[model samples]
Target: HAVVDTTGAGDLYAAGVLFGLSRGAAPDHAARLGSIAAAEVISHLGARPRMDLVAVAKSILG
Candidate 1:
């Protein structure tokens, strides 16, 4: 995603990382999750998730 702005990137990334860790993912895997979440956040204007993150994470992890 382009970095037009980096408003909530870190928070989203942290959310993803924590979500992954809660699911028992490895640290590396968790980082990947954070990347995914941050990507979602930075893709648009706000920090809001366009899609359901839990479902998205489940789909990706599964």
Candidate 2:
């Protein structure tokens, strides 16, 4: 199947990694963050739709 709207996938992935690192998360964990963020963007219409991943991670970790 042909993919559509792959525009901001990279940006959202990078944002996840950066946000993870900002919160002192490990590399693998950060990568998971990237994966989750990328998945979210792909599921939705846009990339990085103002969702607070950091907060989400914090809730999960805590």
TM-score of each: 0.84, 0.72
TM-score of 2: 0.72
Top lDDT hit: 1
| Candidate 2 error regions (>4 Å) | 1-4, 50-52
Ten residues in sequence with the least summed lDDT for candidate 2: 1-10
**Tens-digit lDDT track of model 1 for 1-62:** 47655689999999999999999888998899899888887888887878788887787778
Alpha-carbon local distance difference test for all models? 0.85, 0.73
Model 2: residue 25 alpha-carbon error in angstroms: 0.5
Global Cα lDDT for candidate 2:
0.73
